[model samples]
Target chain A: MAEYPDRLKDTLADFNFVTTRSERAELLIDIAGRFEPVPARIATRPYAEEYRVPACESDAYVWSERQPDGTLKFHFAVENPQGLSAQAMAVILDETLSGAPLEQVATVSPDIVLRIFGSEISMGKGQGLMEMVRTVQRHARSTLAEQAS
Target chain B: MPDRSSETLDLAQRGYAHPDVLVSTQWVADHLNDPDVRIIESNEDPLLYASGHLPGAVEVDWAHDLNNPLRRDYLDQREFEQLMSRLGATPQTTLVFYGDKNNWWATYAFWVFQLFGHDRARIMDGGRNKWHAEGRPLTREVPQYKPTRYKALPRDDRHIRAFRDQVYQHVQVNLPLVDVRSPEEYRGERLHMPDYPNEGALRGGHIPGAVNVPWSRAVNPDGSFKSASELRRIYESEQKLSPDDEIITYCRIGERSSHTWFVLKYLLGYDRVRNYDGSWTEWGNLVNVPIER
Candidate 1:
């Protein structure tokens, strides 16, 4: 089992825009808590083999391990793993609140999408959805940068 | 205090998707057989269709779909109308577009549809990458076409475009041409569309009257769009984009511009948005066109 890192724990703690650390921990545990030990499958079409994107020598990334309750949890080494963009975090909150599938959330609508951590969240379709998460991280970093400046 | 607070409370128009935007690969697959739904693969790569694509998807190459070699970036309404005619698209067709890297071209095409006054368009979330990853069926065989009699809606010329002539006509006018490309591309450090390389590229700089708001800044890492309200707050409050200001977006070859175009026109309800389709590719190549950095 991969151990959760200390920095991630602290960052998760510091995200008081959503809730306190214990509350965040409780949310993570609740969402991913019910897992049974399932075999882990690391399935990815090698970009070099399929798509021809140049391979990096040291391309390290997060991986998920199946828990005893059959759910998958991700772990990160460089930064916070459970640290989602406010939008992504919102999708989870919406799914939890409305009992709708994650697939049902729309990323560009004016509807009152459920808020997680005081951020209204929505989902975009396809790989472009990553743009939404990046937007949040950029906002956070820009906010930090602005404050520093 | 009342005036400022009233301004805060007032929203120009709450723009959004009719049925909300995100749709899973499974949901798309389930509706793959719908007669009213047409799946378009808007890829930069030519072989996207040859390799394999959604069973009934018609191929749309961004380079080919938008322009000929003569005018690569911009598509005049007549040209755009003809392209729509060839695709058998009517004003009423509910275009469900998907692209290889999520929905870059799909979103671009969605913007094109809106420019042409077709509102019934949606992007397939996760795109073909997610669809194929989920063990969904793909076929290399091109589906036989039963061409429908689709007619073009008259171009809403006011909403569709802004030509160099128009910009030149208003050269002294202080309109903001917002370049949504990366800082490198906007500064002319990067060539437009590395695939179709061109020489005589702008040495290094941007439009004097332009602002750099990289499109990638508006997205999440998981390939979804940010919420509209947050997006509004970011672009409006943070970036200080006035609601009434006229904004034009451009990129290397106009693909990325369409992403911002979607955000501005459809997402934020900025109705005065115009895409400078010629972008750098056209503007940079013209011998007499003014060059900036």
Candidate 2:
């Protein structure tokens, strides 16, 4: 009997790999797991970042604002684009939210998911990383507007 | 009484409308007239600094200011203090730094400023190219500056520094070394420092068992860095880096390494990272040190 399935599962489980492998294996796993199989892994956006110019370059990316919950918001920029990774960016936000208890910061999200304050912001093809950034920005803007009102 | 207290602006407190990584040329141009603000042109090339630089800016050579000639890494405290005093920096003075070569030296200076406990320091975005392109003022003549009592207390313990000996220890332990150099240089295709001695230097290649990350890979086309989440993915996912392990970053000279160093320390929040300032210049020059093509 071929142990290929077991080998593929083991390979897919290793989080330490720099480049994620086992795409074919993942597809197989997805097919087996779902009742109805669908092409879900396909990426909609060719380029990971959508904007021709990053929002950080423009004046629109203002630093100081008040969240709807009446907390301070601050921005930090890096000279090199690579320095500000999604996970690293989350760490900064986590640090900034220190003024409020981690619990309070999470009250905006589900109690279970919000319990972890420093969760990584996703940034992949289609509505992955970009979608996450939009959610964070939307919440931030709404909070600021509410505070102002 | 004129209120000098309120006049003491905390640049950090305002949160730099730009973000933590970049400071705009417009902001720098607007504040050029502020008497308290001093700009320093930190360039690896003497000719570039000599030909043109921001008006009223002092020139600091990257090879000299940020490294030790004898040891090939971060400068000793005594030399660092002397350099700060020479730059007319006081404990109270706010220093704005930039460079000719894509803000490499400027980033190194930024690291030095933070290492020496100067919180009011920033790097000019897009550096000299942006400043000059936007028609900001520049002067060829070196402006004379009166020496000031610039108190420097190097936070050595807090800073991420590794001597030659420390790096050797890591190698012995099979630790990962990230070389932020061009692929050519890492693959033994590039050679020689721009202006430094070449007598004893090796022909080409990078440190043994090192990974080439290329410092330029970190920036976008306009020279601005990628977003925080983006940067984190690149380093963590692509580079396969763990937050717990020690990371040693190096380049041809120390300038690019320092830029990466700033990213690893302040941006990625890596606790155990260090810039091998001696980098290829000193490492390649050494007789018996291991090299990999």
Candidate 3:
């Protein structure tokens, strides 16, 4: 059994192999550049606040749902478009885990979060990135809890 | 009190200590075509500049650019020269810096430039936040230009930056220092700023004898610096800091402190001011450091 979502696994594989600081910087810039503007309806206060990325200094939000197919999808935005710290995490999770199955989402261990974002930022700030991934996984698990009852 | 008119005038009209350091958005809009002026956006988030920046502005990441790859310190003179050249900036070019967080990293960039002794730098007052609020233009197109043969002066930290050891000594002697983090962080209630995740600090609280003056107090809601008189009320009257005292400012990281550093050094013309970049993360993590609530 594949321990990771195919999409998340592929994206992780794509980033996991990058070995240089300069390359990591470029990859982050590439992700930051691809801002698909969230519509106002989605970015409104109550909607955004409910799923906000925890502990981010920037005003960041995320909406996650488990599809009928038992996969997870993510939507996220930060009020400060220039807040790279929050954006880097948002971009990584949205790109990797969107529509990922529960098992694969579970496979997104905190270590993997550390692995993905640790080198990109400094290890000193790795705790926040770890929590960010955990937040996403937390949202994914809620769906399982919903179905359990 | 002979000149009543002079007293009534605001700091902008009466002029700042270094009036040229702040350029207005309208001024930047007018000089959009001036080749001699280079707009640089040094945001805390590199992606912000990539999303949309002012026309012809270059992006510089404080972490990737200013910081040395293998060391804890900033880049040396040779690396700084290359960075300036790559950004299409000549020594004579007027580099205007702006970014998110009300020009916090903008002034951080300015302070780093000062560390390298680059004197031709100015900050775009109000930063990107104010610019966006005003409904100004932002473009996703990142600009490129021919590299200049840049010359970097000798690195100078003597007048501006402070290390943790100096902080310890200052604490013992009870020299003037300002703990510019939030009251909670200063009071040992939290290790990080409110709503910000903890950044790997081992312990909390601040250097003994350091006064808690939150950095946010220096700015207006729109993110511009308050008038000089109002600033005096904060630093001179409230905080009881003299203009000539050797003062050190700090926050969780160095960026927030740099904003206060700029205000003291340039806006109010304080003679001796330094930013303790080692700050809370460094202070809180280190072993055997005395901390106060």
Scored by lDDT, the top model is 3
Q: Which candidate wins on DockQ?
A: 3
Residue B227 of model 3 has an lDDT of: 65
The TM-score measured for candidate 1 stands at 0.57
Candidate 2 per-residue lDDT over residues A81-128, each given as its tens digit: 222222233333334342342233333322111112112111111112
TM-score of chain B of each: 0.78, 0.79, 0.92
| Backbone clash count, each prediction separately | 32, 27, 2
Backbone collision tally, model 2:
27
- After superposition, the stretches of candidate 3 with alpha carbons farther than 4 Å from their true spots are A17-44, A47-50, A66-77, A81-99, A110-130, A143-149, B1-11, B140-142, B192-199
Of the two candidates 2 and 3, the one with more favorable lDDT, higher being better, is 3
- Error at B6, model 2, angstroms: 34
lDDT of 2 at B183: 85
RMSD of 1: 17.7
- Per-prediction TM-score, please? 0.57, 0.56, 0.83
RMSD to native, candidate 3: 4.7
Residue A114 in model 3: lDDT = 50
Q: What is the Cα-based TM-score of model 3?
A: 0.83
